[model samples]
Every structure is written in C-alpha cells, then in structure tokens.
Target: MAGGNGLLEVRIAVPAKDASRIARLLVEERLAACAQVVPGMTSTFRWDGEVTTAEEQLILAKTHRSRFEEILDRVGEAHPYETPEIIAVPIVEASAAYAAWLVDEVAAGERP
Candidate 1:
C-alpha cells in the first residue's frame, strides 16, 4: 500500500461543461478517490495580452501522490482547455479514517 503522507489533493479548473464528465471519469478510473465539482467559479486572468474573465468549474481530486503523473495524463487527455490549470497541494494532515478510506476506494480492491 502507498503511504498516505505522500498523498495530495489536486485541483483542476475546467469549463463547467466538462467538470462532471472529468470528475466521474477520474473516480471511476480509480485515479481519484473522490472528486468534488464546484460550479460558478469566475476566473479573471490575462490571456493574449488582455485581461479576460470566464465562468469555470473547479474539480478537487483526492489521491495518493504515487498517482500524480497518472492523474495529470488523464486530465490532459480529458480536459478541453488548451492549457488546463492543474495544481496539486500536499495533504500535511488528514483524518486517518478518511485517508485510509480514500486509499481503499481508489485502489483496485487493495486495502491500506
């Protein structure tokens, strides 16, 4: 079993249309233990030398660090953005039960 301390909670921002689709796929593929889709996010940024704003959805994915690259690959293939926003934040602390459950749920039937 992979260690939980190395786990991460990844955040990816995608257009609202693709949030549910990508989130479901990630969880179903076991790349993410759980995915939370937050809608109605307004993003303001500079693009093409002009400031622009757009409505987007945020996907928060929980998974072991060992699967980071795999998660990235999946997101890249599934995302609609030309350069999707993919960011990861390490979980310094988490409920042991939740962490364990996350590992179990994301595994192919393995338990930690």
Candidate 2:
C-alpha cells in the first residue's frame, strides 16, 4: 500500500520505567508492526553541562518508511526525553515472507 518492499528498523531509547508503555503505544497505533524492548542498558551521555550515566531501555520497532514519520511524532509525544533518540535504519535484506508480512501489517493502519 503505502510503502514498498523497503523496510526500516527504528530505534528509540527511553527510560526503563516507560519502556513497556511506549512499546504498547507503537504497536497499538500500528506505527510499528512489532516493538522489542531491550532493557538493562547503561547509557553515558552529556546532559546539562556534565557527563552523566543512566540505565535505559531500547525499543526496536519494525516498520517501513511509510510509518517512520508517524513513529517519530508519536514517540516524541510519549517519550519523556526533551530530545529522544529516534533513529531509523533501512532494512537492506529480509526473508520474503517476513518482509511481505511486515508491509501488510504496517499498511493496515496507514491512512489514505
């Protein structure tokens, strides 16, 4: 429908406490076909004027280019970070069945 055979893997880093809620939001809105949350990651970064570290969770959302924008907007609203890390990496390769399934799933919720 909206996207082609092309796919994307969107990565969003969120606070550990909000991980599950964010995952459910993406899947429920169908901005993502699936979202896998990986926790227990120690992230080090510069905040304010000092370097800091915190435990965070990573949300890997499987979707397509068609849904990337929506994912960004929705995650921005749902995320706590002033600037959430939202990155989309093109999926260069995937099994035929899996790719097709991914497109179909994401397309279902896309607006006309």
Candidate 3:
C-alpha cells in the first residue's frame, strides 16, 4: 500500500540486455541496497494505438522510500522506452534482521 517500514521494492522493466547494467547502476550508486534481475518475462501492452508483446527483464530493487524519485530519474535516463515501467511498492513486512541490513546498505552518506 502506502507506507510501511520505510522500505520499498522498486520494479523496472527493461530490455533483457539492459537488465544487468541497470541493476548494477542502482546498487553501485547506493540508491538501492540490492537489485535482482529476473529474465524471460513476457509482457503485452498497448503502445501507440497498437498492442505489442515482447520479452523483457525485470529489475527488482530494494531501497528506502526516500530514494524513489532519484531511482525514477536515473532509470528514465538509461531506459530505452519512452515511458519505462518504474514503480515502487512498500515493504509492509520484513524480517527485522533483513530490514536492518537493507537500511544499512543504502544509508545516505555511507558506503557498504
């Protein structure tokens, strides 16, 4: 939903070849604590008054809600699509230890 634990799961759909690069960028930039690339996704959507289907890769990034806008901007610059699918959903529940690790990994002004 809206707010929960200050953590987020950001999803970005990109061409298969660009998945790793985008994931690495987010993690290396410390905007996300972790980025996982899931390949072989088949997506069908309406574009330019036509239905299109394509194979895509999904990048799931774990980060704080505070970093959403920055992630959006960065993905926009690197994404090939005119309108990339970049969305974040709150982490409503998480193990205490894992949550702590995530926060520590992406803490502002700190490198891990």
Cα lDDT tens digits for candidate 3, 1-112: 2246899999999999899999999999889999999989999999999999999999999999878888999899999999999988889888889888888888862433
* lDDT of the structure predicted as candidate 2: 0.90
Instruction: Flag the better candidate by lDDT, 1 or 2.
Output: 2
User: lDDT tens string, model 2, 1-112?
Assistant: 2244569999999899999999999988888989999999889999899998989999999998989989989999999999899999888788888888888888999999
Q: Give the TM-score of candidate 2.
A: 0.93
Cα error of candidate 3 at position 81, Å: 0.8
Worst 10 residues of 1 by lDDT: 103-112
Clashes by residue pair, model 2: none
RMSD of every prediction: 3.4, 2.7, 2.9
Candidate 1 lDDT tens digits, 2-111? 34477788999999999999999989889899999999999998888999899999999998877888889989999988788999998878888988888777676332
Error of 2 at 93 (Å): 0.9
Q: Report how far off residue 58 is in candidate 2 (Å).
A: 0.5
Model 2 Cα shift for residue 54 (angstroms) = 1.0
Candidate lDDT (C-alpha), each: 0.87, 0.90, 0.90
Prediction-by-prediction clash tally: 0, 0, 0
TM-score of 3: 0.92
- Candidate 3's displacement at residue 78, Å, is 0.9
TM-score for all predictions? Answer: 0.88, 0.93, 0.92
